[model samples]
Target: MLELDEKFFSRFGAEYSPNEIIFCEYEPGYEFYFIQKGRVRIVKIINDMEKTIDVLGPGDVFGEMAILEEQPRSATAIAMDSVRVLKFHRDNFDALLQGNPQLAYKLLLIFSKRIYDAKRRLMILLLEEPNVKVMDVLIMLAEQNQQFDFESEITLNTTVRQVASWAGMAESEAQKELTHLARLDKIELYEDRIVVKNIRDFQRIVASRRKNLYSS
Candidate 1:
């Protein structure tokens, strides 16, 4: 929920239609963007296939790492739907940081959290059991979809292929694990979406799996 102000729109506002490519992997980038509306997906090429790493919505920032490090883009960003974004060039971004200390501090916090999440996902990938890995991914997705209501089910707007990619397993294997969970009344999977029964129960399942992992 970035406040869309008059000055902001006049300076850096731009709109992208659904399925548009915002940036491609390995391309040189000089600007970062903040989503003012809609959603975007961050994807990386793995084994010659595109794997979605994340989905970002309004108020989220992307391409900052390239701007900060002066490096080529690490992943491709594409619009998930009609999107409005405010772009900031590297020099302009530096100027804003110097003038707005609070903005700089907020960006620092966001970057740190992203780094920590990446590390945790890496650790999850190291787990030996496919079921454990899948459960960890589902729990992560559930947490991300959680808002203020802890009692409500979280709906994951994602595909089985993407979940399989995140879990480091084949699509069939992921499907089997998901079916098993459904049979146990743990989750409900639709064509391209999943409904997590409850976040607390999801966490309990993950904790139970971790215990089993260590005990065995």
Candidate 2:
């Protein structure tokens, strides 16, 4: 979580529930938020279809880009579950950052990482095969939401539609590829989740896909 002065939160703390819209794409952004709990999905409407670009959990921040750039929002922020957030008006945010150098540095690091991840996803989308694209997205999600357990499996707390959206493919196509991978014993798919049996093997598959992309 961001280390803000108590005065900041006393004025800005707010709560939201699942399916709530925090902000809409292209709308003017007045405030930015830091998640205190739960998750939020960053989505964009492409060709009239909503595509989820990223999921954020506790300690994550959103809406700052628009504030910093002084432009309309680039994407829509929707609550994924019960969420608590600290909202800061543009002036308050600037003041907070000025007072807390460490927080500002942390925000810079987060933005840098997001940019790098976006570039990587773009590269993955350029791959030719839908199967490869699906596998790449699965691996990426697994890495982002890694689960440490005695069983050595990584579980994705996401749905097929979101995965398909990330892969730039239809749900049916993503489901088919996922089922094929499951049949090959590469992963275990449940009604609401997916489990990668071995993280090492998952990485190997992703690496092979990259190799094939280059080799071809």
Candidate 3:
């Protein structure tokens, strides 16, 4: 990310209230935004249901993919709280990039990272079995969600249904798999959270399961 000065944000920033829609998927995107304050949720519609792809915070830039790819918006951005963003339009987008070498470089890195993250998450969705997908989703979140104080154990604020949504499987299927994992002492499940006993152990389990899935 570029070290954007306060002046750059203050000059072009707009405020958004909590739960406000920054942009919607499939809409004609003519501009992009840089988050100056608060958080934003990146959501995609899957099977007529909204699935949150990611939650982005300050210093992050979004909606640029639409402008860069010259396609309709692929996901919707919603304000998670009181938010401030520096909105940039396409008209002078090139000139802005040409003038700011650092910003251009940062955007390129963001593109690369987003693509890799998308492919990584797709791994769970591509799996054949719900049990395998559930385990894969847990592994994915353990790696991706930085809030976890990683060590011997790490807990996450999530539900089985949320994991199912990410895995693109039924909530019942996710619940059944999660119970099985819990019984195996792989994870500690609660009404609102899950505690992964060890990330490496979880990875090993998922990898073995994935291999068997492919072999069979």
lDDT by candidate, in order shown: 0.82, 0.82, 0.83
- lDDT score at residue 18, model 1, on the 0-100 scale: 96
Q: Per-residue lDDT of 15-60 in model 2, one digit per residue for the tens?
A: 8899999999999888888898899999999889888888899999
lDDT by residue (1-216, candidate 1, tens digit) is 556577868888988899999999999998898898999999999888788888999888899886668789999999999999988888897787776676677688889988977876875687777877877887776666546255777778777887887787888999998888888887898998888777677667668777787898
Off by more than 4 A, model 2: 3-6, 10-20, 36-41, 50-58, 79-85, 89-94, 145-154, 197-205, 212-216
Task: Supply every candidate's count of residue pairs whose N, Cα or C atoms clash at under 3 angstroms.
Answer: 0, 0, 0
Candidate 3 residues 1-216, lDDT tens each? 456677876766788999999999989998888887899999988878788878999889999875666888989999999998888888868877887788788788888988877898787777777777787888787777777655668787789878988887778888999999899998999999998888777677678877887898
TM-score of each: 0.73, 0.74, 0.80
Q: Candidate 2, residue 60: CA error in Å?
A: 2.6
**Residue 98 displacement in candidate 1 (angstroms):** 3.0
Query: Which 10 successive residues of model 1 have the least lDDT summed?
Result: 141-150
Candidate closer to the true structure by lDDT (higher is better), 2 or 3: 3
Clash total of candidate 3: 0
